[model samples]
Target: MSQRLVVGITGATGAAYGLRLLRRGRELGLETHLIVTPAGVLNVHHELGLDRKALEAETSFSHAPGDVGACVASGSFATAAMVVAPCSMKSLAAIAHGFGDNLLTRAADVTLKERRRLILMVRETPFNLAHLRNMTAATEMGAIVFPPLPAFYHRPQTIDELIAESIERVLELAGVAGAAPKAWTGL
Candidate 1:
C-alpha cells in the first residue's frame, strides 16, 4: 500500500512549505491528509493568492481549524507520518503537552502515541526557554522539532526554493525517501 501523510498548516508565516509538500507528495503518489487553521486560511489568501476553498480543492483531505471529526483523527486509518509545516507556537505547545483540542493537534498526538514519525516545522522568531523546554519534551516523545532554518549549501535563489528545501527535510524524517536534495558531497 502507498504511504500516507498528514499535512497541518497553522497561522505561521511560511505557508508555502505545507502547500509544496502536498503538491510534491501528490506527484510522488503519496496521499495527503490536510488541515488548515482559520488563520491559515487567511494567510493563504493573503500570501498565496488562494482562498480557503480553493486551497482545500487542491488537497486530498482538508478540514477546518478545530474540526475533530476528520478522518485522520484516528490511528487505525493508516499513515506513514504527520507533518506540521509552519507550525505555530500555540500548536507546538498543544502537541508538546498532549492537548488534542483540534484534529490537527489530535492527529499529531496520535502519531506520537502510535510510535510514528511526527515532524514539526516550527516557524517563530524570538523563542524563549519555555519554547526550548517544550521542544525538548516533544523530542523525548519522538517528535522531530524542526524550526524554519534554511541551509546555504543549496544555493537557492528564490523564496520558493528555500521553502521547498525545508519541506524536503521534513519529508526525509517522515521516512519518505527520494525527497531531499541530491546527496551533498564534500566540495
Candidate 2:
C-alpha cells in the first residue's frame, strides 16, 4: 500500500492536533503532504508559535492552498489517506459539497472519489444547524467527521496526554499500523 498521507490544517482552534499528527506521521514513516489554508497559517502561528516555514518543515511536502494543480489534488496521486486535523466548519461544507475551491478541499474530494479514508477532526462546539447538516453530508460522502473531543476515560493528567491519545485514535482510523490508542477496558 502507498505510504503517503495528505494532511490539511484549517483555521480551527486546535492546531496542536495537526502538528502532532505531522510529527507522528513522520515517526511512522508516512510521506506527509500538507496543505494549510491562509487562516490555518495564522492559527498555527497564534496557537503553536510556528510560522508557515516552520510548519511546512514538519511534512515531506507542502502545497499552497491555491495550488490546485499539486499532485495531491488528483485521485491518481495514490495517497493512503487524507486527514484534516482541526477541520473548520467552512472546510467541512466545501468538502461535503464537492466544492474543491482550494488544494485542501480538492485533495479531500479526490480522497473521497478514490475511496480512500478521509478523516476530518473538526474543532467546533455548540454546533448550529448548518454545521450539523454539513457534517451529515460529509459523512454521507464517505468522510469520517471526527470531532477532537478528549476521552476522559484515559484520565489524562496533562493537555498533551489528551491531545496525544486523540491523535493516536485518528491515526489508527487513517489506517496507520501501530497507531493504536489506549484501549478502554471494562470497568
Candidate 3:
C-alpha cells in the first residue's frame, strides 16, 4: 500500500495550505486521509470559496471530524505522518492538552503517542503567552510547530507560488517525495 498521510484542516485562516497539501499528496501518489473540523469546512469555503464536498473530492479518503473510529485514529494503522494545516489555536490547545474530544484531536493524540510525525502549521499572529506556551508544549511532545512564513528569497510572483512553497516544505518534512516549485538556489 502507498504511504498514508493524515491531514487535519482546522478553522485557521490559511485554508489554501491544506488544499494544496491534498492536491500535491495526490500528485505524489501518497494516499491522503483527510479530516476537516467544522470550522475548517467553513473557512475553506470562506477563504478558498470551495465547498466541503469540493474539498472532500480532492483527497483519497475523507472522514468526519466526529468519526472517532476512523482508521487513522488508531495507532495500529500505519501512516507516514499527520499535518494540521492552518491549525487553529483551539485545536492546538486540544492537541497540546491531549484532549481528544473529536476525531481530529483524537488522531493527533494518537500520532503523538505512536511516535509518528505530527506537523502543525499553526496560523495565528500576535502571539500571546498562552499561544507560545501551547506551542512549546506541543513541541516538547514532538510535534513540529511550523508557522507558514513566506520565503522572500524565492521572489514568488503570486500567492499560489507562496502557498506551494509551504506545501512543499511540509511534504518534505513528512518524508513524502514529490515535486514542488523550484527552491531558491542561493545568491
Candidate 4:
C-alpha cells in the first residue's frame, strides 16, 4: 500500500502547489493529510484562483487548518514524510526551532524530530541573513529546504508548468516516485 504524506499550505504565494500535491498524491493511490493555515486560506484565493472553502468541500480529503489533533500531527501515525509546500518563512522558522503551535508547524516538527523526510518548499526571495540562517538550521536538523526556484530546462511556458516542476522536485526529494515531470531534454 502507498504511504500517507502530509502537505501543509502556508501564507506563501504558491498555493496551487499544495492543491496539486494533494490531488497528485491521491491519484497515485497515496492517502494525503492536508493542512491549510488561516493565512493559507487568504493566500490561496490571492495566488491560485481557487476558493479554499469550495475546493476543500470538493476535494478528496482534508482537515481544518488549525486542527491540532489531526493524524498528521503525530509521528506514530506512520507515513512516508511531510511536505510544507510554499513554506512561509514564519512556518520554516517555527519548524527550525521546534515550535508546534499549529498543525502545519507541528507536523513539520514531528517529521524532523522523528528523522523522517521533511521537505520544506521554503518561499521567500531576496532573503535576509536571518532567513538563510533559519533555512540552514532546518537543513542541519534533516529538513530538505527547497526554495521555489523555477527550472528553466523544462522550458515551462505557463505558470502551471513551472509550479508542477517545483512541486515534483519536492516530492521526488521526499522519495516519492513518478511525481516528477519528464526529464528536460532540449528539443
Candidate 5:
C-alpha cells in the first residue's frame, strides 16, 4: 500500500504527539508529509527542545506553512489521510470555516473536500461554546475531532506511554498501524 500521511503541527501544548507520530510513521515505512505552523515550531522547542531541522529529519517531506502550492495542499496528491496532531483552536476554527489561509489549513480543507480521513488532535482544555461549536462544525463537515485525553485503563506509568497511546489512537483513525505500546486486549 502507498502509505502517505499528511501531518500538521499547530501551536498546541501537546507537541510530543506530533513528534512521536512522525517518528512512528517513518518506522512504519509510511511517507510523512509534515507542515508546522510558526507557533508549532516554538512549542516544539519549548516542550520538546527540538527545532525545525529536527522535525524535518523525522518526516519524508516537510513543507513550509506558508507554501500554499505544496503538493499535500492538493487533493490530487494521493495521501491516505491528514492529521493535525496538537491541533490548535485557531487551526480548528479555520478548518471549521473552510478557510485556507495557509498550507496546513488548505491541506485540511482539501482532505475534507476529497472525502478522505481528517483527524484533529485538539489539545485545548475548558472548551467554550465557540470551541464546541467549531468542533461540531468540523465534525459536520467530516472531520474527526479527537482530544488527547489519556486512558488510564492502559496503566500508563510515564508521559511517553500516555503520548504513545494518543498517537496510536490517532493513527488508528487514519487507518494506519501505529506503535501502540499497550493495545487493549480485554475488558
Candidate 6:
C-alpha cells in the first residue's frame, strides 16, 4: 500500500480524532496529507485549543479545503486511504451524493473511485433519517462509516487512552502494519 494517507477534518465535535490520526500517522511513518474545512479549524481551536496552522503542522502536507486542484483530489495520486475524522453530517451528505464542492469531499470521491479505503469517523448523536441514509449510501459506495466511539475492553483510565485505542483500530483498518489495538484474549 502507498504510504500516503489523506486525512480530512470537518466541523464535527471530535477534532481530537483528526489531530491524533495525524500524529499517529507521522509516528507510524505515513505521509499524511491534511485538509481542514473552515469550520473544522473552529472546532479544533474550540476543542483542542489549536489553530489551523498548528493543526496543519501535524501533517506532511496541508491543502486548503477549497483547493480542488490539489494532488489528493486526483485518482492518479496513489494514496493508501482517505479518512475523515469527526466527519460532519453535511460532509457525509456531500460525499454520499458525490458533491465535490470542496477538496476534502473530492479527495474522498477520488479514494472511493480508486477503490481505496475511505473511512469516515462520523460525529453526531440521535441520528436522523437523512444521516442514516447518507451513511448507508456511503457504505454502499465503499466508504466505511466508522464513528469515533470509544471501546472499553481495555479498561482505559484516561480519555487519551481511549482515543489512542480508537485511532489504533482505525490505523489498522487503513492497512497500517503494527497498528492493531490490544487484542481481547478472553476473560
Query: What are the TM-scores, per candidate, against the unseen true structure?
Result: 0.94, 0.98, 0.97, 0.91, 0.96, 0.98
- Please identify which of the two predictions, 2 or 4, would achieve the higher TM-score against the true structure: 2
Task: For residues 1-187, write the lDDT of model 2, one tens digit per residue.
Answer: 4489999999999999999999999999889999999999999999999999999999999999999999998887898899998899999999999999999999999999999999999988899999999999999999999998889987899999999999999999989876979999978
Clashes by residue pair, model 5: none
Q: Lowest-lDDT window of 10 residues in candidate 3? A: 177-186
The lowest-lDDT stretch of 10 consecutive residues in candidate 4 is: 52-61
Between which residue pairs do clashes occur in model 3? none
lDDT of 4 at 95: 90
lDDT to native, each model: 0.85, 0.94, 0.94, 0.82, 0.93, 0.94
How many clashes would you count in candidate 6? 0
Off by over 4 Å in 2: none
Model 4 C-alpha lDDT per residue in residues 1-187, reported as the tens digit of each score? 6777888889988888888788777677777877888898889888767777765753455778678898878888887889888799999889989889888888888888888999888888889998999999999999988887888876789988888888777777777866765676666
Give candidate 2's whole-model lDDT.
0.94
- The TM-score obtained by model 3 is 0.97
Cα lDDT over the full model 4: 0.82
- What lDDT is reached at residue 152 by model 2? 95
Candidate 5 TM-score versus the reference: 0.96
Instruction: Give the per-residue lDDT of model 3 (tens digit) for 1-187.
Output: 8989999999999999999999999989999999999999999999999999999999999999888999988999999999999899999999999999999999999999999999999988988899999999999999999999988787889999899988898898898866465667767
lDDT of 2 at 70: 99
Tell me model 3's lDDT, rounded to 2 decimals.
0.94
